[model samples]
Target: MRNILIIGATRGLGHSLALQYAKKGMVVYATARYSTPQTPSHGIHWIANVDVSHEGAGRRIAAHWEEETKIDLVVISATYFASETFEDLHWDKEVAMYKTVAIGPVFLIQHLVHSGLLKKNSRIVLVGSENGSIGLRHESGGAGNYGGHGSKAALNMVGKLLSIDLKPKEIPVAIVHTGYLRKENKEGFFEHGGVVKPDEAATALREWLESFDMSKTGEFWAVRGPADIKTAEVVLGPLDTLPTPLQLPW
Candidate 1:
């Protein structure tokens, strides 16, 4: 059975992926930022208090799986998003976003690899956003989102650099745009027609991972294809013309 570790697996796409993988009988390890539940979900091994924003988070996760020879896949899906316009920018929020989205994954992956948790042929997937793409930024709607977009762009760079460092070990790193997701609010959930459910995003992400290999390392991809990207037409042309699991520009 495959040994899969998903960071930030408590909710969103990470939660969906962990549940689905466990249901398929894979040995799933999931991280939580808080204490583990008294009765955890079946088939999932929970690593509690593993906050991706901190450097020690990866070391804690690595210690739990020291006996395992190798981890087949590791996905860093932890993210922090704080809405900000130029006028309403918050320094604290931006720093938090940068720590979680860009800086944390680097140290976490380093710890995993150095600790022998991730070996040759292992895959590392960093969950990024389409908004991170510099090439796709057009005047249509490229304003605002200072922290979210900027940090994700930093994440893409970090992932690419990691791929280069790990290439010798045959570890392929992929940065991906999962999908435009719906936001859960106090009132309820709200989303546009193009926004996909977390489960849908998880399913698509798994499919994309199946085809990912060393040759595709250090590349960015849109797992939900180009249809859900609102600005795809303005930057890359008509969405209908693009293929599913499209290769994204940095």
Candidate 2:
């Protein structure tokens, strides 16, 4: 079985992805922030106290991996979101969010590569959002969420740089938007807002990566196409004419 490492697997898309991968009998290693792995048990091997926000997170993660095991896929799914308007911006929250969303993944991947856990065929997926897209932001016309949107954009840039740096090793690095997800069904949340449950979004992302290769490295994509994007038609022309997996603009 192939070895897969998923960071931030305690909840949301990360949790769903870990469970699904474990159920498929892949050698799944997952990380959690708690001193004890608080994630629901589903045969996933846990790496506890791995908070991606800290600079030491990568080193902590590296210590847990066995020398004999080389990871086939590394999914950096750890994310922090803090909604902020100019009037009420929280400094601490924004800093934490930026570190988790953009800076932390760098150190984690740096450690993984330095530890020789990744081989040529290994791929890295940085979970980004369409909210990162400046073009979309202009068309969609929503204000606020500065930290959330800004950090994701930073993540895309970080992923691009990583792809360039790792090109010699042929490790394909992709930045992707999973979807607008609903962790739980809230009132009218599942009605028509294009919000999918975590499981469904995870599956869509998994399928999208089947054909992703080195040629597409450093590219940003919406794993489920442009259907869920608020301004897809305005930016990408006609929605029905677009492909299932859409390449996003940075």
Write down the TM-score of every candidate. 0.95, 0.93
> Model 2 misses residue 69 by how many Å?
2.7
The runs of at least 3 residues in candidate 1 whose Cα sits more than 4 Å from the true structure, single-residue gaps closed, are 37-39, 185-189
Writing each residue's lDDT as its tens digit, candidate 1 over 75-193 gives 99989999999889999999999999999999999998888888899999999999899888888875998899999999999999999999999999999999977766778668769
Taking the tens digit of each residue's C-alpha lDDT, what string does model 2 give over 66-111?
A: 6487889989898888778879988899888899999999988988
Q: Candidate 1, TM-score vs. the true structure?
A: 0.95
